[model samples]
Target chain A: MTADISLTPPDPKDFLDTDSLFDEEERLLRDTVRDFVRKEILPNIADWWEQGVFPVELAKTMGDMGLLGMHLEGYGCAGTSGTAYGLACLELEAGDSGIRSFVSVQGSLAMFPIWKFGSEEQKQEWLPRMAAGEVIGCFGLTEPDSGSDPASMRTHARRDGSDWIINGSKMWITNGNLAQVAIIWARTDEGINGFIVPTDTPGFEAHEIKHKASLRASVTSELSLDDVRVPDAYRLPGVSSMRGPLSCLNEARYGIAWGVVGAARACFEAALDYSLERQQFGKPIGSFQLTQRKLVEMMIAVNRGMLVAHHLGRRKDAGTLTPHQISFGKMDNTRNALEVARTARGILGGNGITLEYPVFRHMANLETVYTYEGTNEIHTLIMGQALTGIEAFS
Target chain B: MQVVVCVKQIPDPSGTYTLDPETHFLVRPDEQVLDDTDRYGVEMGLQIAQAHGGSVTLVSMGPKGSMQGIRQALAMGADRAVVVDDADLKGSDALTTAQVLAAAIQRTGFDLVITGTESTDGYSGVVPQMLAELLDVPALTYATEVEARDGKVTINRQTSAGYDVVEASLPAVVSVTAGVVEPRYPTFKGIMDAKKKEVEELTASDLGVDTSLRQRVTAVEPAPEREAGVKIEDDGEAHLKVVELLQQKKVI
Candidate 1:
C-alpha cells in the first residue's frame, strides 16, 4: 500500500524550537531555506492564492538555493540527509502548503523516481535540470477514479516500436499545469511503469482545476495525456509494478509528515503568542485552564510527532526503515497537526479565521494533508497489516 | 587562501539609541546581532573561498553576549567561527577591537580579513584599513565587487566616482558594502552544524591585546541632540537670516 504524497516526515526541530537537533551544515540549509521562504514566499502567498498563481520561477529559485531533492548526494543536490529535507519542508510549509506541495511533488515525487530508478543517461539528462529548478516535474499517480487505489488506474502505455504511447488522465496534480517534466505512471503490458513525459509533448494538455481553497497557493490541475509518446529511455528502467508508484508515494508522504509539522508548529507558536499576550478577565487567556490545556495538548502532539519523525528519519538515513514506519508518521503527524491547528484556532477566538493569524490557513492545509498519500484510514490499515503480517489493501 | 570574517553584534538601530542610565552612556544588556552591512563582507569572503578553494574562518568580537551573531554567521556557511570575549574590551573603540581580532586571526593564520564597511554601534567603518595597516597587508574599502581569480583578488571599490576595480595579489583586508548578494539562509543541517562547530573562544589578555596600552576612552558621552531647523523663506530675509546666523556663530 502506498502512503500519501507527504510521505516523508520532516524533523520537527527544523521548524519547532527543539533545543538543538541539526548539525551546523543542516542548520545552515535550514536557516537558508527559512530565510528564503520568509523573503520570497511570505510576501506573495496571499497574492499568489488570490491570483491562483504558482510562481513557476520559484522552482528555479529554490533549485538555485540547493532545495530540490536536497537529500540526494551529488548531481547538484545538497548531499544532505532526510532531516535536511524535513527542515526544507518545514520552512516551505511554514509559508503555505500550496508552496510546499509544489516542492514535494517536484522533488520527492517527480525527481526521485528518475534518480532512484532511471538509467545513467536519464539521470544525466534530467537530474541537473530538475536540481536547478529549471525543469519542473510532477508525479502522476492519482487518477479521476483512483485516488486511494492506484492499481485500478486507467492510464496505459503500449510499446510502439522505440517509443511508448501513453493515454490517460492524472488528477489533483500539484504543479501539473506548469510541469517541465512528469513522472507519469501508467499500466503497460507487464504492469504499472513510470515514464518521464515532458509537458511539451505532442498530445499533452494541462488544465488548472478551477476553485481550490485548500491548496490555493499551489497549482492543482488535471492532466490529459492523449497518445503522449515518450522514448523507452524515458521510462524508469527498474519500475514494473504498483510498488514503483508506491515508492514515489512513500517519498512524497514522508515529506508531508515533516511538512505538516511545520504547519503545526506555525499554528502552535502563533497560538502560544496570542495566549500570552492576548488577554481577557484582567489576565492572559493563557493563565486559564482551558487555554493552557489546549497549548499543552498541542505541545504534546508536536513532541510525539517530532520523536516519530526524527527517529524515522535517522532510521531512513541508516537504511533500516520500512514504508510502514513512514505510514505511522504521516498518519500521526498529519492527524496531530490537524488537531493542533483546530485547537490553536479556538485560542485565537475571532482572529483565528483571518489570514492575519496563520492558524486558519494551517487548518485548511491540514485538510489536504489528511486526504493525500494514503488517507489516515489507509495508513492505519498499512500499519495494522505490518504488525499482523497481513495485507489489508483488499 | 583561508579568510577570516570579523562581525560585531549591535542592537537594532531602528529603535531609539540611548545611553546607560548608570554608566551615563551606551545601552547595557544589548542584544547581539551581525552588523547590518558586514553580511556583505562575509558573503564576499565565502565567494572568494569557493572560487579559490579555501575556507572562511568567522571571528566575532564582543562580550560573551555576542555568540548569536557568531552562530548566525555559521548558519550562513562560514567554515568555522571564533569569538574574542573580554570584559575590558566590552566598550573598546574600533582600533582596540580590531587589535584583539587581529591577534586572534594571527593565531588562525588567514590569507585575508573581511569586515563590513561599518558596524551599527561603531559606525567608524575604519577597522579593516587599520587592521590591514597593523598586519602589513593591502587594505581595500567599500568593495562593491570582488572576484578571486587563481591566487589574485580583483575588488571593485565603491568610490565617490562610481566604483574602481582594483586587483590585489594575496593576503589583504577587504571591507564590503551591503546588497552584493543576498546572504544565504541557515538550513536545519546548518543549525545542527553550528552547534558542533567549535567556536574557539579567546579573551583580550589571551590574545595579548592590552587595552591599557591602546588609546584610553577616558570620556564617552552622547553627541548633543540637534535642534529642530527653522526654514528661512525665499527673500532678502532669508539672506539676512543666514548672514545673522553665521554672524552669531562668529563664522563670516
Candidate 2:
C-alpha cells in the first residue's frame, strides 16, 4: 500500500470575497500591514508569547512605516481614510491582538487625546514625535477599581502653583512598561482632566503585570503616580469632564470592532487548514459534515464582523457615526468573534490547546479583548439605553 | 537631472492566475499589483535623483486600471507619474510597449531612464534595449548598481562570469536587476502624499505612437511537470543505495 502524505498545508479559506468592498487605497493599506505582519510578527510571535514580552524594536519599525497615529491629520501622521485605518487594524490583529493593541493604544488612546484636546504646545511637542514612533505613549484611564465605570476613578490631580500634581494608578495599560509618555486621566477640582505625564518623572512607576494567559505577546503594566507634577500647559485644555477619556475609548472601541474580526479570521484559517490536513477514520477530517459546519459558521461570523466594521468606518469618515452605532458594532462583532475563536478551537482537537497553532493564542487573546475598551455587557447596555431611552447601566 | 522609471502592473505571483483557454492570454483578476522586479528600478531612480537633486517621474503603458502600479511608484517617493493607457494597446508586444513608453518618456524629458531587466510575466528582456534604440540612448542592461554624477553614468552590469563596469554619457537607459537595492515600504505619509502627486494620463494619439498589436498569442499551456525523485531515508544503507542508483543510471 502507498501512503499519500503532503508536507505543506492547504491555502487559507476565504469564503467571502471581501476585497470587493474596499477601494484600492484601502486594499493597499491592508496589504501593506499584512505584509509587515507576515515579515515581522508571525515568525517570532510564538516565542514572544511564550516569554510574555513585546518586541521593543517593533515600535521603530512600525513608526518608520507610518503605523503610529496613522489616521490622524498633520504632525507627520499618515492621514489615511478611516476605512484604511480600520483595515490596517484588522490586518494587525490578524497577526495578533497584542500587536493591534499596541497600535490602537498609541493612535486612538494616547495620540488622539493630544491631537483632539491638548493645548497647541502640547500638540506641537508630542504629536510629531509620537507619530514618528520616536516616543511611545499609553492611555491611563483604567484603574484597579475603575474598570467598566470610569467616572468612579480615584486618581486625582491637584493644582500647585503653575504645576498640576497628579496622583493615581492605572491598571491593564497596554504598552505601559515601554511607554515614554502616559496620558493619565484624573479627577480635578474642576472635573476630570487629562495630564500628559512623562514616565521618567520623579514619581511615575510602571510595573509589568505578570502571569497573564491572554495577550501574552503584549506589554501590560500597572502605572502608579505619586505626586507627579507637570506644568498647567500639560493638561488638555479642550475638555474638563470624563467625556475626554470616554471619547478616546469610543475611538479605540471602534478599532476593536474591526480588530476582533482579524483575530477570528486567524483562528478560522488555522482551523480550516488543520481540518483539511488532519485525517481521522481513514479520511481527512474536513470532509466530515460537522467540521464543515464549524468552518461555515466561522466564515460567516468573520465576514459579518468585517461588514459591520466597514460600515461603521464609512460612517465615521462621513462624520455621521454615532456612539450607539459604534456600541452596536463593538458588541456584536466582539461577541461573535469570541464565539468564532472558541468554536475554531474546538474544531482543532488537541492541537488547538498548544501555542504551536494560532487558534489557542487568538482564543486566549480574544478573552481580554472581549472585556476591555467597553466590555460586551457594557456595550449591550449602551445600545439598550440608546434604543429605549432608559439608563439600564445604573 | 530628471529621471524616468518604467513600471508595470502584474498579477501577484503568490496568488492564483489563469489564462484564457480560447485567447491564450492572461485573464487577470480584479486585484493587480505593481510588479515586484520593477520596484528596484523605481527605488534606484528615486535614490539617484534624490542624491543628485532632481525629480523621478514614472512612465507606464497598460490598461485603465494600471494606475495602481503608477500610484504605488509615486508613493515610493517618485515625484509624478505618466500613464499611457488606451484600448488599442491591448495585446501589444514588447516592441510596441517600448514604442509607447519611448514616446511618453520623450514627452516627460528625462536625462536618465531606468527599467527592470524583464517583466515577471513575459521575461522577454527586450523592452529596455528596444526603448534605448527608439530613444537613441546607450543601453545598459542587467545593471546591478548605477551611479550618475557630472553628466556621466556608470553601471555595474552582471554577467555569467562576473560583473562588467560600463560607463555611458548622460541621457542613457539602464535596466536594473532584482536586488539592486532593497525597496523601501511606502510609509503611510508617503501613501497620503502620493494621492496629491501629479498623474498625467495620455493615450496613443496624444503620445503620437502606433498602438496596434503586431505579435499575437495563439495559445497558452502550463509548464511541463517534473518527474518525482526517489527519497531514500538515511538508514545506514542509504549511501550504498544512492551509489547503486547512480551506477544504474551509468553516472558512476
The chain A TM-scores for the candidates, taken one by one, are: 0.93, 0.96
TM-score winner among the candidates? 2
Best by lDDT: 2
Could you tell me which 10 consecutive residues in candidate 2 chain A have the lowest summed lDDT? A7-16
- Model 1, B1-252: lDDT tens digits are 888888877765545667765544467354455666777877878887887788989888877563666777776678888888777775577788778888888889977788888877767777888898888888887887777666677788888979888888778888888876666555434555667787888888898888864444456666799999978887766888898999999999
Chain B alone, candidate 2, TM-score of: 0.91
DockQ of each: 0.25, 0.51
Reference-based TM-score, model 2: 0.90
Clashing pairs in 2: none
Residue lDDT tens for model 2, B5-82 = 999888888777777777666776545778989989998998998898999999987774735666677778999988
- TM-score for each of the candidates: 0.79, 0.90
Q: Native-vs-model 2 lDDT?
A: 0.89
TM-score of chain A of 1: 0.93
